[model samples]
Target: MGSYIGKTPTELEMAGNEDEEDALGFKLTVLRDAMIHLRVQFLHFQSFYEKEGLENIGNDLKAMKIILMVVQNKIEELKSIIPEYLEIKNIGMVKQKIEDFDLVVTEIVLEMKEFERDNFLMEKVEKLINKLNPFDVPNLETLDQELSPNEMMKTIMSKSAKKQQDKMNKETIQNDVT
Candidate 1:
């Protein structure tokens, strides 16, 4: 495994000016780290509960852990998409595609947040959490093909622009010849 000496990949990507937003980012990182530590503690607690024959509670904890893992994986997947997106020179051409991607990702993040905050589902999840079983939701291995910059260029770019540019070039060449 490659060892990073300083910032993690996300931190490296997120480096910014030391401004008000930067302060907020620092605070967010602190909160995030605290939440992660609490999650680890919960995992240990769940293990203890399982050993004590409190299978239902253990299962609930396992289910929660699985949800956390899925969210984290989704976050990483989205992060990986950013550089590919920024590398595109013809960003204006793929404006609609970019908007679509943003919309989908925002909805996904909102759904997950709502899932976490859902008080109505707490009772149901407690009862059915045991049935959820095995702490691995499927990874998003197959993201939308159009989410790829190369794929978007190939499939979604407006051919009209190119055709227009070609026409202009042809007219220019003919004018020069005359």
Candidate 2:
């Protein structure tokens, strides 16, 4: 909404070296835009077919998935553009950090790639919305208490959070006794 609207992402805001960030940012944005374009293209295909008829969509899905994979590979490629940072002193920890970094980056990119796919869905969503009448909404607003936040939303404590709290309380009680 501010200065970043038309400008590229600044070097420091990104994780890699400044030159790498600059170069990669431009390239990534291009690829990201291409991904978005493909998404739009697919949506247009979907809408054209939905309104007209279902042409063979099998190849279309395959092509879209391949594009998604290329985008994923590019995301992994960014990690290579910079030296890896190690949080721990040991070699094993550094190795683990590398794996962890890969996992986190992959997770984030995959999430974004999913959004690419979602954008395709959104482009054709209006037609879908029109196609689907009010009766098709599945009445999920009242399906489950957890899913609904209507005063009846029951919260569940995850096991680890509960265990940590219990351990803290036990430690506090022990300290008081001492």
Candidate 3:
């Protein structure tokens, strides 16, 4: 993520100024596009499994299709609700819809991949679903800035510390063995 260095989300929203709505529209658009992509992918996999006569896998794909349909409905609902919520500045319903969409995506991913772990098509669907989760919305407010510079530095240091500790432990074990 690039650093917004000196701008806030409110500032960016003001900059856009076309309609005084929350900048969440971009996230919604991405979610819709991702759903379309997922639908096409599921359809393709369904066709492949059908041709291969993999009945069970085909059924799983069908379930995935159903999940997509629900997701599509939720996206539509959010589309309408977001503008109204923004105007009133009450986003409770909007937040709830997003949460619901996230839950359905989670269910689809699990249903498609968990039981039939080895089904290659299902595995692909699961990964795609995870990648496209709407709740994983990028914060445009921070798009102009690194979202977590401090957290990132801490993670890097922690990883290095862990690596050194593991190496020391391994050396000690080797000495004992010798």
Best by TM-score: 3
What's the residue-level lDDT of 158 in candidate 2?
Answer: 44
In model 2, what lDDT does residue 7 have?
52
Model 3 lDDT per residue over 71-120, tens place: 66656666565655444332443454455456556556565655367634
TM-score of each: 0.25, 0.33, 0.38
lDDT of 2 at 50: 66
Q: For candidate 2, lDDT tens digit of each residue in 40-88? A: 5456656654665534655655565565466456545644642442321
RMSD of each: 19.2, 18.7, 14.8
Q: Write the per-residue lDDT of candidate 1 for residues 1-178, one digit (tens) a residue.
A: 2334677777655453223334433433443443354355445644655467444454555555565555344444434443444433443333333333333334333433555454223322232233222221111222211345775564464657645754786487457546
Global lDDT scores for all candidate models: 0.42, 0.42, 0.55
lDDT of 2 at 117: 61
Please give the lDDT score at residue 122 for candidate 3: 50
Q: Per-residue error at 73 for model 1, in Å?
A: 22
Supply every candidate's count of residue pairs whose N, Cα or C atoms clash at under 3 angstroms.
0, 0, 4
Give the top-scoring candidate (lDDT).
3
